[model samples]
Target: MTLNLFSQFASPYLLGVPLIFVASISPWLLLPSPANRWMPNRLIAIQTWFSKTFTKQIFSPIGPLGHKWALILTSLMAFLLTINLLGLLPYTFTPTTQLSMNLGMAIPFWLATVLIGFRNQPTASLGHFLPEGTPTPLIPILIIIETISLFIRPMALGVRLTANLTAGHLLIQLISTATLALLFSSPLVSSLTFITLLLLTILEIAVAMIQAYVFILLLSLYLQENT
Candidate 1:
């Protein structure tokens, strides 16, 4: 029974092939393509506006050096946002919920920022591992601690997204299954459970959006540090 409850998190397979890629890429395919006309249609227009607005809000606080990443970061934000929201649908699987997939993204982006910092300003990068005016004895300890913290950032990013989405999905499944079970036995209780499920679904939607934003925002913050 416990294993059955967690079966949703398992990747769906057909004919011995995983459908994770299809699930991830389908959202992008559903997006509206731009027309050759001077003005885009309403869907495209809204997409453009949202992308521009998000890019501005995210990059406004970043330094000029970080501004160079605007396009890549913005696209990543959009991709994450789309996949997360789509995954909330009844039959869809969220690729972001997979820790392996999330880590794949987190590591490269975080490493890139670190590499950039090292290339452009090695002193500043290394300086992050040790603070100024450190006491002689604690200096080594502090440096080791800071270095560990630095390496932990990417794992934190990946685990945060994975854990949040996984927990939400589990709760939703639990409530939904309960609601179904109680329907015939107790309509009133089932109705209440159903209402709670609705509210939970709405909150999950917000969480899905926010988690994506937070992921990119943290990456941008990392970029800001290195830049």
Candidate 2:
């Protein structure tokens, strides 16, 4: 009973071994593969449309140089979108809810962009630390602050994803628990709570999609600065 209540967010395991990798990769297996024929099915058509639309949205504002990232960014969004929505299913675990997992994905991408900027435009990259014509004493302070903020990007990305999913899951568990507890005690309250849960579920679905987009969108913004 206790396990069922919180296992949705906990790292999954059979006996003692961790099943996080399995849970994390399960979402991708559900996606449909493209057919070999000329004409495509509805699902393929919809997937292609979404990929194109998302790629355009992310790359449209940025320069053409960064357009190459369309495949990577779009695939990332699809992966996150799948895992997040799948987590909402009964008895399922969400890997994105883990801060470690999110950071693992975020830091490398963020660092790669920073490295790209350094490699391509060293002077410009360093210029981001200390602005033009800064006061002597205040220069150090500003550099320190900017450096800290720059490093905070990955942490923020991981925390943002982790916190949103964690909060939503916890709330759903709490509300659902209250609903079940009240089922026999108070039918009126239980029914209303159930309806509220329904609404919250819908909201979480939207949140899952939006969070995935936001993650990719921010990465694209970072890539824009470098590319």
Candidate 3:
């Protein structure tokens, strides 16, 4: 029974093709494209406004040099936001819940910031490893510790996203299963559980949005430091 519950996380296959691949890319189609008319429809307009607002907020802390990432970062935010929200619907798979996929995204973006730091300011980048005025005795140990922390950033990003979504989904599943089991035994308790499920679902929606924003916001901060 526990295995059955976790089976939901397994990638579905059809004729030996992974459907998760399709699910990952499907969100792109949901995004509105530019209209031929001078005035776009409401959907396009809303998308534009949201993108602009998010871009401004995210990049404001970053210097002008970091603004170059606005397009890719904004698109990533939209993609993640759409995927997370869509996954909340019944019978849908969330790609972000997979550590592999999350890491795939986190590593590249994180590496880009690190590489930018190395390219633009190599001294500052290496200086991050060893602080000023450190005693000679502890210098090597601090460098090792700081280096480990630096490398851990991408893993943290990926695990944080995967863990949050996984926990939320698991809780929802457990509560929902209990609710269904109690439905035939005690309608009152079942109804209360259902109410709790409803509230949890709403909270998950907010979490979905917030997680996406946080991912990008952290990336922007990394860029800010490098710039």
State TM-scores per candidate.
0.97, 0.94, 0.98
Best by TM-score: 3
Using TM-score as the yardstick, the better of models 2 and 3 is 3
lDDT of 2 by residue, 1-227 (tens): 77675667678688887888887778778778889989999998899899988887789988877777788888889999999998899977789999999999999999999998899889999999999999999998999999999999999999999999988988898899999999999999999999999999999999999899899989998998887
Itemize residue pairs with steric clashes in candidate 3: none
**For each predicted model, how many residue pairs clash, with residues at least 3 apart or on different chains?**
0, 0, 0
Ranking by TM-score: 3, 1, 2
What does each candidate score in C-alpha RMSD?
Answer: 1.0, 1.8, 0.9
Q: Write down the lDDT of every candidate, Cα atoms only.
A: 0.92, 0.90, 0.92
Across residues 1-227, which tens digit of lDDT does each residue of candidate 1 receive? Answer: 78987788888988988989898888778777778899788999998899889989998888899999998998888889899998899887888889999999999999999999999889999999888889999999999999999999999999999999999999999999999999999999999999999999999999999999999999999998998
Name model 1 segments beyond 4 Å from true.
none
Clashes of 1: 0
Residue 20 C-alpha lDDT in model 2? 84
Clashing pairs in 2: none
Candidate 3 local lDDT, 1-227, one digit each (tens): 88988888888888999989888889998897888999999999999999899888888888888999999999999999999998898998998999999999999999999999999999999999999999999999999999999999999899989988988898899999999999999999999999999999999999999999889888888899999
